[model samples]
Target: MKKNLLYVTFVNLVNGFAGIAFIPLALKSLGTEGYGLYSIFVILVSYIYFVEMGVAKYFTRTIAQASNVSEEQKIMRSATGMYIRITLLLFIITPILFFIIPKWVFPTNNHGLVSIIVIFASLDYLLSIPPTIKLTYNLGKEEFEHISKFNLISGLSKHLFLIGSVLIFKSVILLIITVLLRRVFDILYAKKFLKSMPKGSWQPQYAKGEFKKIFSQSIVLSMAQLTQITILSIGTFLINRNFTMKEVGIYKATFDLASKVSFFSNSLGMVVFPRFSSVLKRTEEKISLLNKMPLYYKISWLVYSILFLISLVIIPIIPNILNIQDMELFYLLLYGACLNAHANLSYEFLQADARLKEVIIPSIITLLMMSVIFYLTLDYYSFYAIGISWVLSQVFNSMCMDTMVLRKIRKSSSITTICFNLIISIGVIILYLSLGVY
Candidate 1:
């Protein structure tokens, strides 16, 4: 486990660096307005995530729960078939979205560029569905090190091509082109990997039945996931409406840095989620595993805190280089990530047991809180206010989800765990006030 964990963590670190590497070059070459334009497109592309609608999460847990490789393979095939159908549905919807999204997200003057970008981006998202299902299969099987290496190769290749495009083409159109090519390559790679696996018989009847079962669970999970994605991306959308593209660029820069902290939590969470699903029927094992989660929660907070401090030291030295701000914004994002890790884990824990509806209300409330707060505060407050509201909404949602998760597991809350959380909360508050957070 430690070996795999280290490899996965290293891969995540590489992925994070690869992501951040684009910003400086982009800022320098494209300038704030150009980058902001690109950022809006990127955010718009991310809405495809909402369209994905928790299908991958459902696939991962279901595949992980399969009794054997043959069962896992069948699940994979069924998921692929279901995704093919979903893609076909998107084929009808996507054209309309391409027309509508550009008009909604960008200025009317740049409709041509935005329209082209949305079409390509939407195509990229569709092409990615197959490869993502394969990747989820690997994760469900706990092929951590193998998946990590594959991701490293894919990530490096994509970023290297992107960096070259920055120098040679320096066009957002080319950037979207790179995205389309990368998705094609990823799908080919995933197909090659799946072909190497032992073939399992997948009857059309069985595949149809499996799709229905998975789709039923996915409908609920999709709503929950949509809420989560909305909470994360609402800032960009709101900022685009009320602020300048330059301010949008600035806000996105902060959001990106903060999102890197989330990479740490997700790196571990990805590994643990399948394991939780694997042990769902065994109460003793599940309890034992749940008992160990607080340590991980604490570790997530600790790592994020250290990263926050490092950003303080590093951002000032090269403030203009990466478009980094001072510490307050980072702290807000870090705090949000810390609060969110446990809730995210809880969501996985409950989902592992096939409790899809348990989190629906909390998820809805989270979306509402983030939307209301961000909309109300965007005019009166700085971008950091958006960050703060994000953290607060996450806190409320996390508490609600955590309560349900604990009750479902038949575990009483521990005082020590509660104390650790309070300590972290108080410490963050002090740190925020000291930094003159507004």
Candidate 2:
């Protein structure tokens, strides 16, 4: 576990540097409108990739709990088959979407460029299925070091390639193609690793019963995933629909900057999820781990709070650095990201324990609330409406999940801790609104 955490940390660190370089470079090469188009393309692909429907998480949990090698093989085979079918479906759907989405979503943009980029990006995602399934299997087995090394190589290479390619070519289409080529390397590495494991073919083999079982177990998780994606993407979606592409670029850039803080929570969740899955049936162990949830929250809160302070110093400078406007979006989004990090582990814990409904319910409510807020405030707040909705909804969602998690283990609710974080979050918002610091 220690080694896994260390490797993940190193991977995220390198990728963090890559991210720091990638965005400003992208902005320089693509310009604000071009970058906005690219962001929309990426978000569209994410929505399409929802076809995955939580199969990866399902495989991870089942494989972790599997008692024997044969069982693991069966799980992998079903997963491979499921992925293949999904890939085929994407082949048919991607073209149709590329045609319709640009016209409907961004009628003013270049449809030709958007279509070409979306097609290549969709293909990149399609080609990634095999490698992703294999890597997910490794995750299920707690082979984090192996997976982290793969991520380190894949992530760093992709970013470096994008940074250099955009500098030279200044083409979003080329960037998509670059990502597709990088997947070839990923597939090779995942295949090599799978060969050393116990005998199991990568060939797709469908077992109707197994497929149904996996889907049934994963559907709730899929709902949770879809809702989460909607919540995150809604801001970009709304900004693009009702405002200028330049605003879309600014919002996405600031959101990306704030999202970096989530690296800690994301890495921690990755390491602990398998542990949570493995102990699902063990009451005492589950309780013991649940008892540690507050420590996890505090660690996450501390990291977020520290970054929140640093952001106060840095946020004002980002507009000049990135040559973008509306720097204030960073603060509200940072607060949203912090609230997200606080509840991230609890979400993972619930998912691993197959209590996904608890996770999905808050997410659904948050999405509805976000939509209502966006509707009511868009005329008054513009892009700031998106930020306000996200922060408020995240606060509600985080508290609910944390409280639910504590209740699951028969522990007293950490209302004090929850309230403390809530107070700080609210205070930050008040400060931002009253002082109007940008």
Candidate 3:
């Protein structure tokens, strides 16, 4: 477990550099309008997780519970066939949506090109799923080092290709092709790794009642995932639709920087999930988990504090480094990130306990609130309203998760503490807005 945590942490650290570098290169090469279209394309790809129906997560939990080599192989074989069907279905449906949806959502003049790019990108993402099945299997088996090693290769290749393609071609078509080619390489490496593992069949077959059972369980998780994605992307979507692509570029740039912190939390969550699943059935082990909860929470706060401090120092330099004009959005986004950090730790625990409802229910509520608030304020405030709505929604979500988490763990959390945090968050936002500090 310790080794897996270390490996995943290292992978996130390496991936962070790529993430930081890729944004400026993409923005410089594509320009604002082109980058805005690219942002929509990426958001569309992110939504593909909705189509995935949480089957990848189901694979992790199912395979983790396997008793022996034979059982594990059988689980993998069944999962691979199921995943293939899902991928094929997505490949077909996504392109059709791309054809129909872009016309209504984007400027009519650019619809044709955007549709073509979205189709290609969707196909590329679908093709990447076969390799994902293998990677998820390794995760279930606790082969963290192996997963991290391959991820480094694939991660570096993806960014390098993105940077090279954007620098040379400055074409969205070529940028997506770069992604497709990276997936092709990843597929080859994944297949080679599988061949060296305990043998698993790839012959597609539908097992009796198993698909129904898995889908039933997975759908809840899928919904939770969808809500989470909406929370993350709603601001981007609203900005793109209501404002200029140049404004969208600024918003997404700030978001990308803030998301680096989330990348670390998610990496740690991935490590925790399967390990927690392993001991979930044992009562004594579950108690042990509770006992260590404080330690985990402490560590999480420590990490968040370090990240928050670093952001304070780094955000001012970002505008100069990337040659961006606006740094106001960074203040809003960084505050949102700090608010989310504590809630994310709570989310990880609930997810491990299969209590996904707690995390996602608040997300659904916050989404509705954000949408309404952004709409009501759009005429008067424009993009600035989106920033305020985002921070307010984060506070709402943090309160919901923090309260539920404390109750579940039998930990005492006073109303004074929650109210104090809320007051502080609101006060800080007020200060920023009143002073126009950002």
- Whose lDDT is greatest here? 2
**Which of candidates 2 and 3 is the stronger one according to TM-score?**
2
Q: Sorted on TM-score, highest at the top, how do the candidates line up? A: 2, 3, 1
How many backbone clashes are present in model 1? 0
lDDT by residue (tens digit), candidate 1, 1-438: 677678778888898898788777776666666677777667767776666667788778877777887777677777667777777777887789777887765664577877777777678788787668768877877888668877777787788877777777888778768777887888666665443433642322234367667667688878766666677777777777777778777777667766776665677678777887888778898778777766665665566556655655565566465556445666677667667765677777777767777777778778788878887776677666678688888778766766665554334454455556657766766775676533
Models, CA RMSD each? 2.9, 2.4, 2.7
| Residue lDDT tens for model 2, 1-438 | 777888777788788778877888888888778778778777876777788888888888888898998888877877778898788778788878887877886555577877776677687788788787877788888888787777877888888888888899897777777777888888887766442344664666786587677778788889888887887788888787788888888888778777787777778788888888998779888778877777677666667767776777776755566444456677788889888887888888888888888887888898888889888988898769998888888888888888777675433447666766667767766766776666
Q: How close is candidate 1 to the true structure, as a TM-score?
A: 0.89
Per-residue C-alpha lDDT of model 3 across residues 1-438, encoded as one tens digit per residue: 778888888887798888788888888888877777777777877786578798887778877788898887787787877787787788678767876757665543477777886677677777778787887788788888888887777788888988999999998777877888888989877766432445744655578987788789888888887888888898887886787778887788778776677767767777877887787768899877765665555555556655665555666655567544356767677777777766776676676678877777788999998888888888887777887788788889877876665564544533544555566566655655675555
TM per candidate comes to: 0.89, 0.92, 0.91
Please give the lDDT score at residue 267 for candidate 3: 75
Q: Count of backbone clashes for each model? A: 0, 0, 0
Positional deviation of residue 271's Cα in model 2 after best superposition, in angstroms: 1.2
Alpha carbon lDDT of residue 150, candidate 1? 75
Q: Which stretches of model 2 miss by more than 4 angstroms?
A: 105-107, 192-195, 314-324, 409-412, 430-437
Q: 1 or 2, which is superior by TM-score?
A: 2
Clashing pairs in 1: none
